[model samples]
Target: MTDPAAAQAPTTVLGASTPRTPPARLGVAVVHDLVEAIVTGEVQPGAVLPPEGVLSQTFGVSRTVIRESVKRVEEKGLLTVAQGRGTSVNEASAWNVLDPVVLSALVEHDDSLGILDELAVVRGVLEGSMANAAAGRRTAERTAALQHALDHMHETIDDFDAYSQADVDFHFTVMEQSGTRLAPTITRILFDRARESSRFVGAPAAEALRLTLEEHQAVLDAIEAGDAAGAQRAMEHHIAEAWARRRLPTARD
Candidate 1:
């Protein structure tokens, strides 16, 4: 006879219980701290981490936080855990460096690597096809968007970070203009991976940025002209030059 909502309310016994709140996440922050330490080799490979209770107390957080943090590092292949034993750091090669978080950690410590060359290889194949398709299929709106990104690149040339971001945008616009899901998806991944590696921040070697902007113009021109072959060639050449710049040997030898 009672209303369902009222009937469903808890009937508390004397001094029975209080409601519980879900634990807060100290996990992500804890994991990031450990990741930085590991990547920086402060915690050497095969080193065992302090026990969960110790870590929880040290960080003034719950054991749940410590457990979740360990789990995250394990997922990144940076650590291995065994029941009743402890967690141990893994070798650098074992980590998923392509994972954005891991890549950010790695790049924070060491910026001199050819990681961008690998990224450029993936972009070259996928983006070249996208450029060709865009040349054939681009709508006027999409072409204008691409041109706008190129213009922004020129405007931002004095700011390496801004120019790099605009460069990424220009490439992404070309992929989107292709009107294909796969190319755009791959291009996004490639750019994201490159950003994580922090490979695009420095002023590219003198003339490199200028050359890239010119190549971008070439691709835009071909796309506007509806010359599919020219667009594809221009895109391929741009990617090739990018890879070459990224792979140029250091003079430290």
Candidate 2:
């Protein structure tokens, strides 16, 4: 016969620990899939989700799973649930685009050009500020990292995908050197938009690559020389050139 008191003793001895078991939350994964579908416009705003019973049956899970998934989507501002009414998709503005799920949605939506342009504008502002700050605050190590990225860009000059990735890295490095949270966050968001655009992966114009490399060099030189004004101007020029290269049709033109 086992002693009830001995059996009741804590399994974890003072500091000795039991193996940690990972959480078993599949709700987040389900929520992400649904949210992604909505953001990509596969399920437009105001579109109702399948009934909870249907979702549970389809996913081979319980109503608790469905409810948890819906709750997660609601927290991301992608879903709306009511007592009598069903769950429906929310507007694009309701989403937190900086959230990775939202970013993926923006990329998946083929017609997200408008949002991409808006993102570019925001990026210009953020990167410009970061360049200026880096000019003033950059250490030797950060400057060296920028130079290395530039070298990588040159080496991959013939590879559009590689070159574009290096370009993103160079800008991100500058923002990191600025030692500020906001700039890095905004730069990341901008790069996410760029990746979604998918315009830089194919055969890019040689002229475009040359111009971009030169622009990056200019920004690097300005940052290295500690020329804040020059850095800001160079960054703005680089971004403007990229915008123009995208050949995005304006409302008037």
Whole-model Cα lDDT of every candidate shown, in order: 0.77, 0.76
Please write out the lDDT profile of model 2 over residues 20-76, one tens digit for every residue: 221365676666667766765667898788788777665556789889878877888
Query: What lDDT does candidate 1 reach at residue 21?
Result: 24
| Candidate 1 lDDT, 51-149, residue by residue in tens | 887677666668887798789889999999988778999998899876677777765565455455556676787888899999999778878898899
Model 2 clashing residue pairs (backbone): none
* Residue runs of model 1 more than 4 Å from their true location after superposition: 1-25, 41-48, 57-60, 90-94, 152-165, 182-199, 204-206, 225-230, 240-253
Off by over 4 Å in 2: 1-29, 40-51, 58-61, 82-88, 139-142, 200-202, 247-253
Best prediction by lDDT: 1
Residue 92 lDDT, candidate 1, scale 0-100: 84
Model 1 worst lDDT run, 10 consecutive residues: 12-21
The CA lDDT at 137 in model 1 is 93
